[model samples]
Target: MLRPELIEFSLDNQKAELKIVPNLHGPITEDDLLQLLALPDFSYLCPLHAVITQAVIQVNQLHPQDEGNIELFFEIAERRDAEISFEIASDKMQASMALTAAYGGKSLGLRDVLQNLKLQRISMGLSKAKIEALLVEFATLSPGEKCHSVIANGRAAVNGSPAKLERKVSLARERLLQPQHNSDGTVDMRNLGAIIMVKPGNLLIEKHPATQGVNGYNVYGETLIAKPGKDLKFTAGNGTEFAANNPNQLIATVAGQPVETPSGMQVDDVLQIKNVDVGYGHVDFKGSVLITGDVGEGMVVKSHGDITVMGFVDSATLEAKGDITVSKGVIGRQLKDLSLSTKLIAQGQISAQFVQYSQLKAKGNILVTKQLLHSHTQTQQQLIVSDASARRGDLVGGKAEANKGIKAVAIGATADTKTELFCAMELTELKQQLKQLDQSIKSMVVAGLNIEAQLRKLPPKEQWQADAMMVEQVKVMLEEKRRTVVFRTQEELEFEALKLEIEGYYKHYRIDALKHVFSNVELHVGTAFQRTQREHGPCQISNKNQEIRFDYSH
Candidate 1:
């Protein structure tokens, strides 16, 4: 075990000294001497150690009286100036230096240290007064004694501010005023408040300009470039445009809802359609959509904003970045007819009067007013099926999964349609992911092993005796292979993190059937799952003590 601390260098870098601790860890070998020659700090002294056996002999002869007292006395050369070793901060914002007194010659003056800094390319933020004081302090210290002081500091670069959008009016405040739920826990579907409308020439959004950031220099006088703030442009959709007088001001050209889009703010001018049939091709709009008639089979509607269907939707596909509201029923063919079956995916909340044989997925809540029959619905948030008017909403003959919770007036029917409901159910998905990660990691490990084997066989750049171009190409290839190994290691770290997360994470969720829960209804809560053999009037399903528990409310 040869340590770099055991080796010492002269102040002028002309000679070297080896120290021997009191521990007798066997005699020094050729390999030990070779290891010392390979160190970065001693690479400058490689010309001094040509013979490995001679260097090993020098190390083996160092026998100290005590392990603590291991400093060897070296004969100082004719005239050595004081050694100034710099220590720069990791962030390059501060720099300090330590002075080792000259052995048998004059100490360094202020001019000498300044010339040394110049040679080191440290031209910025020099403290001349501090250097003068440090020179005086160094004079008081004994020869070979060390004194430390701050020499230079650099200013850090300032990051620019991000562009901002200032809104004149807020639709979020109006939504807060309009309550979604009544005192009875039932949703107030009708009193959800009117849409926020903006008049012509009304300023919807105002943009602030981004400013350039100031540049800073390091102790080495190298410029540290600053990152300017991200600039944003107003996204004026239909019925909206930039102001004629001011480009930064976004104003509404017509009356419409002032909807905040992902890019910026926009006036959500609705696009009304009589029907979506074969005659009318797929509808893809940047704004909200309003359909008065039905969306016939094989039709597809996509919008960056919300999609509202006043009439029924039959075997159609509706994809919206915002919410999807269907006034009437959304009917679809069976899952067997995968191509023609209705599918609805929304980033926001989804609300429908009734959904049958359709597939629905939403980031927010999925609200069904009447019934969800044989539909596979999933939501990151809660899923509720309750009709305020009829007081009868059922989830039957399908899979309903939600991360938060699931609430319905009725679950399953007398026919025992094999309905399945899940709350916070992610075990299967996680297991599948683990399987994929395992496969990927195994492949990466094998590939990394092959790369390492190839690297071991290839000669290093220093040892190569090939053409310059060939050596350069080989060096690049080696670096690329090593980078692949590094990437594989990072992916392995991610895989381990996923495993740890799966081990520690537990989903907290519940399922509530306000009315009848018929037989053959399968309920899954977290990791616990069970099926109802007999009908239950009303019950709350949850996981307790790692087991599925059914609490009858009435």
Candidate 2:
């Protein structure tokens, strides 16, 4: 029997050694060597079994008693293949790269990794410092451990800003009507309303050009172009012109009030006054009018451009073709019945601090800061009665109409003020215009028929062969009448089409009311009307199925 201690194996089982100790009984034989090798457990070394067996045979043939130990079998360990992987991503603006360390292979140096990356064609945005750090980390990691690191990154381009325009013109002073505090902590109403007047050739606006943006660099060190800034052209409207020296500067041409509009800037011929009282008399200016003081009772102020009153408006009439802005409130005081007899009419918008016992109408929007009490207000667009702070925003009115919508913080008072609100009212003016157009079209059709009948009464062209001069004159007259008939027919067609379009626009009218609505409120949408007996909040009234419906969900 072979002793187990006769052969020795390494920990990894890659090599086997046989001990050649001097035997006390007999010399070692080939069978004894094979038995000793087999006893040491060489199953894991099956791939190298032939070499191991040959080595054992050589050892048996030598049988040197002097040699204490001999290497009987050896096998070189096989390793897993070295693997390298990378992650790359990029967009139009930036790019990035990451690296994953190779596993189960010989230790890699910085140079070796760099060579491998180069051979793999990853030359863009390579960071030497990051590569060195990854190599250092790779050197410290144990076998089968992975090291992942971000290697490269690219920068993004910057976009340019658009050109800006700044207006330097001033209009009426926008002053809040809060009580002024004195040194003794007493409050008083100190009117701060003032009119801003400008002379001719005054600077109205200035334009600043856009700036160029910076370019960017990609991972491959390629230049990325940046979007250039957009330029703006100066729009000088009526009564305004560009400066002679600088095109970016705008200057007023005539001495008037500077008005800023959506299309451009204009200077309206103005009529500036201290007040509209008995001494100053009523005013009806061709252009805009700026009153620095109040319009006393029984006075009128009318303008073609705009009417800007810097003080309170008494029981008077204010009319304008553009807009009407009253710095203070409109009060109809000392009236017999306290009805809203003071009228305010504007083709554009009407903005006021407060309106009480007054009648106001505008083709555009109506913006009130405080409240509308017992007044009648109508607007073609939205009606907004709220400040940014949402304080004193109440609409306890008699009647109000807004074709677009109405927005307020509170609708009625706690006493349940009877407020009548109408939205998307029927386009009566357009409908009337369409009716008149239809009448005109009918009249034109009749006229066209009459002209055709007159043209048909003329002699035929074949009769001209007998009398050339008479035929020529009659033919000219007939041709003129025929042209009139054709033109009238075209006009009739155009008018009919316009009437249809207006009818379609009137059919799709809608309105909405934001915030709370109280009791005793009558709402009218189109031709339908609804009265609320109980208070409903955050509701919207619209015309549906030829009936007024209230929607409280939103």
Candidate 3:
């Protein structure tokens, strides 16, 4: 039997030599050398198979009777690669180590394996327990045996959340348009449920901010940044303010309907009424008026804000600081006493489904969806009589006047009903009224200037010495300040009114008859007038300079 000690390696283990002692009893076989090469101490050097075979043949060639020494030189190399190797993930979130028994070279220690991992930039999540376990297992393994295990891991980053907005009030206006049913199972047509209203200091909306997410790290010791949440801000509109105690909370500063705008919320002071009939007396309110039902004969309805009539207004007197919207018709009788006729006036626009035998006046436009028949319609802006959906309507037997423009599908009936359409005409009565408004505005301005001068002449409050004379002077100053406020308020109102009047006077005057103008229709623009000699189709009459010009589309 060949002993493992018979084989010897060079100092660097790059070369090896083996000696075969003559077996007096038998010759050495190939299996004998192979079995010797498999020993733990000598197995590190791989055997050259051809060299071993030749050595065995030469040993057998020797006569069994003659004993001799046999020496063989074997080629070998040191295993320079480490027994422990690492595999890292592309994202650096996982790392694993592979261990094997070394041959012809020194086996790697745990420190060596760790150093190799450091060179790969994997420094974050190394597990000492796993490394020690793998190293112990590697030590106990036979040559060329392999052991693989995970050694490191990493954390993933998380994204943040977005901010949220909470509304305290129901800003939906659909409920206002829908009629509610009574407990008796009957629909209250006149009482479309009460409008959403908010008093002063009532909460309207609140905002909650976003949060920053937690950060994470990888096996490479690199920081993973977290995405922060999106933040939001409260958008406050007119008559709305942020709460004194909470900056995130929004509140209303007036008693009115809560209107949701694109950017935020607004509060408009409004007066809601079921009807303007015998049950309700002559109504006068400082805010907008919402009439759910009809306004009966001789009923007077007035407001500082807009007047919205869900139902009809029949032979009633209605006035408003803002627009007037009649969902249904405005009906009246052409009586000898004009005061008995339906009179609807507004500082803003007036819109109606239909107006028959009524007097309509507005500083802004007058829009009629259906026919405006036998009515006296006056507006500083356009007078339009066309169905909004069908684009068809008639200005039949009416005296319609405007400064800006007029548009109608048909002017006068096919029966040649007399119709008058006037634009930019300077009426003596309107001129007088304008003059009176200008004078009133001038008077207020003068009074405001006088008040300012008087206020400036008064002693400054900081310089006043506390005494009986100072007290009396202070009282006089307060009274003058109150008077100044009153005059300033009135001046602003009058100035706005006058500005609107002047704006109306400087409009470009034009009239468009979309369909046809009957023969009896009288067209007037500025200082010029013309009567349609015959039925005209699709024509436009405009005041250019001081003359009226007609353009026929067809």
**TM-scores, each model vs. reference:** 0.44, 0.50, 0.43
**Global lDDT of each candidate:** 0.74, 0.69, 0.75
Candidate 2 per-residue lDDT, tens place, 72-111, comes to 3433222333445666565523233333333333446666
Off by over 4 Å in 3: 1-255, 258-266, 338-340, 426-508, 544-546
- How many residue pairs clash (N, CA or C atoms closer than 3 angstroms) in each of the candidate models, in the order given? 0, 0, 0
Which has the greatest TM-score? 2
Candidate 3, position 141, lDDT: 73
Q: Put down candidate 3 lDDT per residue, 1-554, tens digits, no spaces.
A: 66667666677666566665554413777787777766666667556778878877766766363554444344322343346677888888889989877656678897798788878888887899988898888888766779988888888777455567777886322332345789999866446565557899999888786677777788888989766555554588778998889878889999886655434566767777888998789999876788878999989999776688888999999997767878778999888775338999987778887789999999888888678999998898889887643357789987998877899998898788999988877644456776776676577567667766866786766776557797686678668767755555544444555556545542445788888888988888877788877888887887655566778853
Candidate 3: worst-modelled 10 consecutive residues by lDDT: 72-81
User: Looking at model 1, which ten-residue stretch has the lowest summed lDDT?
Assistant: 71-80
lDDT of 2: 0.69
* TM-score of decoy 1: 0.44
Say what the RMSD of model 2 is: 19.3
Q: Give the clashing pairs for model 3.
A: none
What is the TM-score (0 to 1) of candidate 3? 0.43
**Between which residue pairs do clashes occur in model 2?**
none
Q: Candidate 1's C-alpha lDDT?
A: 0.74
